[model samples]
Target: VLVASFAHFCSFDRCNSASSSSVLLNALPRPADPAPGHLQCPTCVTVFGSCPQNSDIVTCPNGTSHCYNGHIAIRGGGISSSMNIQGCVAKPSSFLLNHTQNIGVFTVMENRNQGDERGEDWNNPIIQAGAAPVSAPFLAWVVGLGLSLALWGGAPSLPVLYWSGPCPHWTS
Candidate 1:
């Protein structure tokens, strides 16, 4: 049995601005098995800034192989910023992908070998572990909550899911 719990909190100040915070709870019965040939890749996240001077190396989880580097342009509440990121990806087929939702606007762009022309350097020291890829449904929930908070100007309670046993049977 495995259970994963996620909680998000959105706060609103008297200034009528909203900010969000999230927590992830992993209650897996045991550590997951390692994927064969798991390769470590450089990774970093820079908010409202240029690419990081140095990147950490993280071993991609199962289903991820190639490394990725890119930026996400986000605009909301009369604010705009670029989120620079570098990490491992499962499918590196597309060079770019864009997505927008109600919580303002944002675009995610991918670029491989941005700093280093030779995209095959794996000997770099890793400063920290990369963030795990989030599930689509979870992302949607977060976005929806964020949008609701921003528009309605109130703090809403987020639902918590509890699951036990082999992955529960539920359709996304």
Candidate 2:
């Protein structure tokens, strides 16, 4: 009976520690900006920053720019600037729950059991497909290879073939 009780206490302690750790990790002080500057953004939490390549960015469809602290900036159809983050906790003045009524809720279920009944799980499908994952190095390699092949290796490399009417030399 004592052993069972100790085991139960240990499990409870583990659970509590796990919950506290998650809360701490999620609520850790966000990184601070290197310098102070006028920040323009819709929300504090929506800061932009460097993300791994292939990370998705959902943006405004129209032409206006959305600037946020710690978020990378999209300019002229591409990413132009890195995000400078200044960590600060924001407090709402009042408890306003009605504003979220319009938002929809979705439920996610986690399967904790390690069972063979589950199908194959793919964390990253693109890797399995043999496609490039869009890292900076991979992108550079692709671009360099494409440029070299387009300019040197193929038929386009021969200037004579461009005119192609059987006259060889240039005239004045």
Best by lDDT: 1
lDDT of 1 by residue, 22-59 (tens): 22323223344445335555555555665544454445
Model 1 scores what on Cα lDDT? 0.39
Q: What clash pairs does model 1 have? A: 56-127, 57-126
Global CA lDDT computed for model 2: 0.19
TM-score of each: 0.46, 0.15
TM-score: model 1 vs. ground truth: 0.46
TM-score of 2: 0.15
Question: What is the C-alpha lDDT profile of model 2 across 88-153, one tens digit per residue?
Answer: 111211111212211112111111112111211211212334543322110000000011112212
Model 1, position 45, has a per-residue lDDT of 52
Q: What are the C-alpha RMSDs, in order, of all predicted structures?
A: 12.0, 29.2
